[model samples]
Target: MKIDDWLLEILACPACKSPLRAESEELACTSCGLIYPVRDDIPVLLVDEARKPS
Candidate 1:
């Protein structure tokens, strides 16, 4: 199952305490420009997997 809105409520960026938006197959933190990938509908909120800002 995918990470629901309830789960998102408690999810914060590891680098910065910012809200995230659902991107294509990932959750992106707008403030820090971190992209948290989602695998099998599960959000991988890891700093290593996060994409750096362009």
Candidate 2:
């Protein structure tokens, strides 16, 4: 829930290269709307591991 601003600034959606915004325990894509999980404060950015946009 609390990712560093600098890190967040560099994170992008693997699907669409869109910016990611921290949401709960996941990162939501701004373009494709993919939801990537965050575990132990590390982001899981694999496209296959992302949740479908809802």
Best by lDDT: 2
Q: Candidate 2: deviation at residue 42, Å?
A: 0.2
Instruction: Single out the weakest 10-residue window by summed lDDT for candidate 2.
Output: 45-54
TM-scores, one per candidate: 0.80, 0.91
Report lDDT per candidate. 0.84, 0.92
For residue 16, what is the lDDT in candidate 2?
88
lDDT (Cα, tens digit) per residue for candidate 2, span 1-54: 668999999999988898999988999998888899999899999999999866
lDDT value, residue 25 of candidate 1: 76
**C-alpha positional error of residue 49 in candidate 2 after TM-score superposition, expressed in Å:** 0.4
| Residue 2 error, candidate 2, Å | 3.5
**TM-score winner among the candidates?**
2
